[model samples]
Target chain A: MRNVAVRNLCCGVLLVAVLALAVWAGWVAWERYRAANRPLFHEIGWPDLVPAGWTPPDVLRGMNVNRYQDGDPEAIDALARMKNAWADAPAVKALDGRLVRIAGYVIPLDRENDEVHEFLLLPYFGACIHVPPPPSNQIIYVRSKAPLEGMMTMDTFWVDGTLQVSTTDSPWGQAGYTLQAYDTQHYEVPAQSNKS
Target chain B: MPGILSLALRSAWNRRTTLAFIVAAMVLATILLLSVTQARRSLHESFSQAVNGTDLIVGARGSNVQLLLYAVFHIGDATQNMSWASAQKLARHPAVAWSIPLSLGDSHRGFPVLATSQAYFEHLQVGHGELLQFSQGRMFNDVYDAVIGSEVAQRLGYAVGQRITLTHGAVAMPGAAHADKPFRVVGVLAPTGTPVDRTVHITLAGMEAIHLDWQAGAPLPGMHISAEAARRFDLTPKTITAQLLGLKRRSDVFAMQRAVADEAAEPLMGVLPGVTLDQLWELAGRGEQVLMGLAWVVAVAGIAGMVATLLASLQARRRELAILRAVGAGPWEILALLGLEGLGVTLAGMLLGVLLTASLLPLMSAWLEVHYGISLAGLSLDVTSVTMLALLLAGGVLGSLIPGVCAWRMSLSEGLAPRV
Candidate 1:
């Protein structure tokens, strides 16, 4: 009788302890999942997307970006975390028609055939066709008419315009950063080289 | 306490097989975890270094992802080439610093051929701002000269002056090779652990000359020009697929992007390499989390093994438990002894595992540097790893109590007249 009672107690304790452990693990996993699902960037209303007259501060930090490359679509999961802070962006926008400034390169500049005069803008610095593209560097589609002269080769350009969110996904469309341009202007200014 | 630990070591030495099994488990777990971490680090290093030290990249006005894939990694071919006029206009910006044109349409044995200038080696930066260096020969200067990366050189067994043909598009199966304009190997770059290691770099004129006779990737029926005779045609590339740009003033990147878009030159898009690299990093975070989860599983497995072993050995330790009780050792003392044994075994295994990791790190570093480009010099225990070890030790001790209870019961049953 004593042996049977002891066996029963062992079974009962093991079952309860294991179940408790499982429940605790499940709770931890649930919290982790919840944390992952939470949005990282708080999007302002449409009007708040653009900060009107932002320029390079007294201390300008030059970030290298490859404009010809595309954004990494594999990171579509964390579009929210790519802030100007994390992604060197001016502002994070999940939609289009918002105004923002972007900078990058002009890969294969086409001046003759023009439905839209636009350039591929990178956030950092590089243009290599045979390498994988970075995700934060987005394609800036510009709507312009007149062809400007003397902007040749792979030169960095600052482009200011409104962000037009792409509705459809293209082979080039990836997650993180994407903005089309409207009312775009080019700036070629003398930069104080600190070798940042 | 030192004497007790020495005694414990002696006991472990006596049961070397059992101890060895535990150590083996620990080593395997460590290797698996470490291997995954190394792979993640190297993969990211390779990826980010793919387009490093670049101010901007410009490509076709298609999907940004498509542009990136074809332009940088050479994974796919660009659907179409952008106009040279547009590239020229964007390059002339006053804020412009350095620029390189990349023409991609041809391939050689499934490897994409990049038509670029000699400035590629001088300006191209990768892996924490390291520039490309030639391991074998000099950079390409002539029209028929080519520069290949380290892996390409090794894989193809290509040497200086060895002739090679460029193919059209990414052809895996039998495809047409550009027999007309065979290129001679000029230089081979040392491994940078970047995508450049897989490419064959050539002059832009060579790319144009190779396709002079071929129309739409087919032979122009009997219109063949030998590499010697191909110099008659103007070899200047009409259009390139992509371009890299640097700024005289870094502030002009956005302006250049806008000028290319607004300056009636071309319909294009510019992107930042750093921003996109962060995106890739985010994509790999989940893999990191998954590996960490597996590491936790191994830890749990080790704990369960300790518990099972302690419980299994209780019968053999029954007499010891009775002897302790006879000599005024209480139930708590029995518990403490068994707990100490468990802790000792786990601690030993963990220490040995850590030592092995440290010793093997240099060899691993050498292999990774030569092959995968990961700097594994900092393989010492981090806070998280230390915490894991501590948790394993504590859990092992606590888990032995299950068997310790059995010993307590045995002592109660035997009392002073316990049998060995």
Candidate 2:
């Protein structure tokens, strides 16, 4: 009778131990699944790049830009003023060195074969060809440690990286921000999100 | 289970010859697939490493692709050379940090000659911003001095003090050699695995001096200008094949490209090397895809052969399996026996294939370097290769299961009776 009782006690302990091990294994697996599915970088938008209550210089506030003919002196002067304003555009200092994700169009700089290593990320398409380029604050120079394959000019991508307040000098003038991108994905419309 | 595994092994050993043939086929297929992928990767890496640091290649207004081929790879002739004045103007631009002018169209013993200033040695970068290092001697100082690349020195058996003459064009025709103005080899550069390794370097003055009396690609008759007398005349280069430019700020490249395009004095263009390389790949990527597809077909054929061999043996093994079922073994044991054999054979084949590839790659790498000037990285099992091997493993096991299922059905129906 004592042997039977001892055997039953051992059976109960083994059953409980097995159940506990299964629960612990399930918990670890669930944690891993959550981590794999979670989005890594915080999603941000173009407006986040600009500081609140800051406005662009109104160099051409009253002038009618379209009325002037090509090579008109007044038009040229206005264009120069606009360029100067864009060149000195201020960046949002608070967001410097923040890891964030934003969608932008690519203008490939350094590349190898079909892989792009460095590029300019603009908030809108045709920024290079448009009459007036985007302000310095709107331009984000992105660099990748490993080359991104099959990236082309004007291709939109959701770039995730650490943003910094930096400046790049060009003919039009200085760009205000740069990104050291670790990941870039094709841009897709978020489901059920309101599109402006 | 242990007994079943041993039975499977012994059964496989009974038909070692057939299994060996299947394994050999798998080995050949694996080598082919891996080599194609490796070659494609190395080709891109070699091209990219050749022009790593230069921001732009400015040449005469023409096809960007043509300019890239001529300027970077030295594969073809430049249609026209841009004027020295335009090159100087570009050099003086605020955004231009430095520029190296290149003058081609001369050869020495079938190797193309590159004429540049002292800046080339100081500024030109290769293989990820690595500066050129001389293995022996130094850069040319005298007007008649020459610098040979590593391959040029090794192949021609030249030393630092040897004298060599330039040919007017790429090919060596009779009397085309510039025998009057032989250049002394002042320097020998280390191997860079680029077009540079196949070239002979000289100053722009040396190039001008050698051709001072020549006109329209031929020597002028009755006009013999000695090397000493040639120095008295102007040695300033009037035209250059191309110039490589580096920018003060990388973001200034697009604006600088536009500025070069809009030059009113001369028709000139600037091409981003990386962008142009992408264009070249797009034109040739279809051929690469076809090669990869053929590799896949070969791999699939290998797996199919393994399946066929295992199925053929199943008919012969039916009696063996019935005997096992008769001797206190269950139907599942019969199934496990065949499945284990198929899996074991495939695993052995894969191991041998990997070993063979590892041994063969170094020899292949040397051959490719000597023949094509491509430098391949060492045997690296990157994610893509690992994934391919994994997929092959899955396919192998899945293919072997077919024979296993057949034996299971045969054992269930036969039941200790000889069906064969």
Candidate 3:
């Protein structure tokens, strides 16, 4: 009985050691897998306030941003399609002159007294900084009634404003939409939750 | 099973000196294989991620890789500068959304000084679509102000508001320093893990201002203009080494490239950075393969050492094997015991290698990033590495066959002479 007990004790210890190693490896693999497929954002809260007639921003990017052909009629046609794509983008007629809230990083075009009133609001940081700005549709020209203080370039902000679907060309890049913002607050992303 | 393992452990401990040497060989071999693979993978990744978002690199007629090296990586000097007129004309093209001109041929303390317009800060990109971000201060707005990269700032211990002077040429030769015109540090960019982190940036006006009185690469006699007064004159740059172009549409890249190549104003060349980078990888891939081959040879030698030690020990362990046979252990059990012992050493060696790599990476990661533009992968083993180690253990077991057979024969022959 004592011999059997010693044998069982050895087996138990070996099994536990193997299980610990296996668990650690599995956890690491699962974390890596989750990182690979993480969603771009969680709700960005756009649809909650979007009017019945309006379309989401990604829909515009999907339409004509990824594909284009150069030369002759195809070039002209592609340009037209791009133009129309922006015009019909966010295709919500109701969003025009409607009050909305959005978040983006600032690309200051003009500043005064360390304050920013006219700037490009970008969906991501680094846009218009050291990299080519994203598609015009991805940028918004924001003009604030009250100057936002301590506005550093590339700082994120949540702006409450009236949304306008229009295009404006700046020295830096082009913006397909405009925002007459009344309130701007610093932006922060909540800690990511492990959904899987 | 426990009895077999206990016997193997006691036997290995009895020859601990030889066994220790075998373990050390396995450890070195494992480290060699893992590091070579890691280095090759990271080198490929960092190189490919060097340039992105820019549609075309336009420069005076030159090799595509050469232009890429000089313009994007600051690795080589440009053969010739395209006329500033041509650069402006390229910028004004209808399909061009933005253009960032690059003017090289200057250095500060061995770090290249990149003279470009504000557009470089506004449009140039690095790995994975990231734009340059200032860790402190802001972009240089005056001709006498400069922005340094993270590596330059850390190495030289410079901070915002510090002053620096650049040399006229790429190297800091005596009397080549533009000491008459010292620039204030207006900004410092965050660590980028690219060549950009080792560069110093200044405006086009800054470049022209420093050379205002210089002719034929020497300062003109009796023409010392103060940095403040130099700003009074027109600092319009007449030439630039290269330009990165961003098009209104991605499809226009090929057309714009052809136009630049066939440009009548000057003999210019244009290349897609991504395509040229792929060509560079093809050239580098062969060297990486040779390194990996050498590492495998080391691993094979290590396995041979393990086999030799076990085979040589068979004569001394003959009475021990006979005692096992007397206790009813079969020939097949003797083989299994020897194979298991080899596998245990291999597994222990692999674990030690992984721990050593993991510990060394954190200490060396920053140094590697600053020097080689390589951010070592984190400690967790990837599937490929884990699979490789498993195969290594399998090979170690196979290598024990000669020793296993010798032990089996000794056991069968000496079963009756166990007392010896």
Using Cα atoms, each model's DockQ against the true complex is 0.03, 0.18, 0.02
lDDT of 2 by residue, B310-369 (tens): 899888877888777766667666655666666676677777877888778778876666
Rank the models by lDDT, top first: 2, 3, 1
Give the interface RMSD of each candidate: 17.0, 8.0, 14.9
TM-score-superior candidate, 2 or 3: 2
Error of 2 at B191 (Å): 3.7
- Candidate 1, residue B314: the lDDT equals 68
Report how far residue B144 has shifted in candidate 2, in Å. 3.1
lDDT of 1 by residue, B1-420 (tens): 344345445655766786567656656565555555545555554565666557678876766666766778776557778877777766775556777888887777756689998767788886656789988899988888999988778777988889998877777445487765678998889887666877889998888778877887787897877776777777867788998887653324444454454344557877656445544555667978988789768877877776776677666656555655655665655565667777777777777777776677677765654443234544545565666667766776777777777777777777766676
TM-score of each: 0.61, 0.79, 0.68
Give the per-residue Cα lDDT of candidate 3 at A61: 42
- Tens-digit lDDT string for candidate 3 (B234-314): 999999999999976443344466567657888998877755765576687698889889988999999999999899888
Docking class of 3: incorrect
Better of 1 and 2 by DockQ: 2
Q: What is the DockQ score of candidate 2, to 2 decimals? A: 0.18
Residue-level error in angstroms, candidate 1, position B55: 1.9
Superposed model 1: Cα runs more than 4 Å off: A1-196, B1-19, B76-79, B105-111, B155-157, B263-265, B323-337, B351-420
Instruction: Order the candidate numbers by TM-score, best to worst.
Output: 2, 3, 1
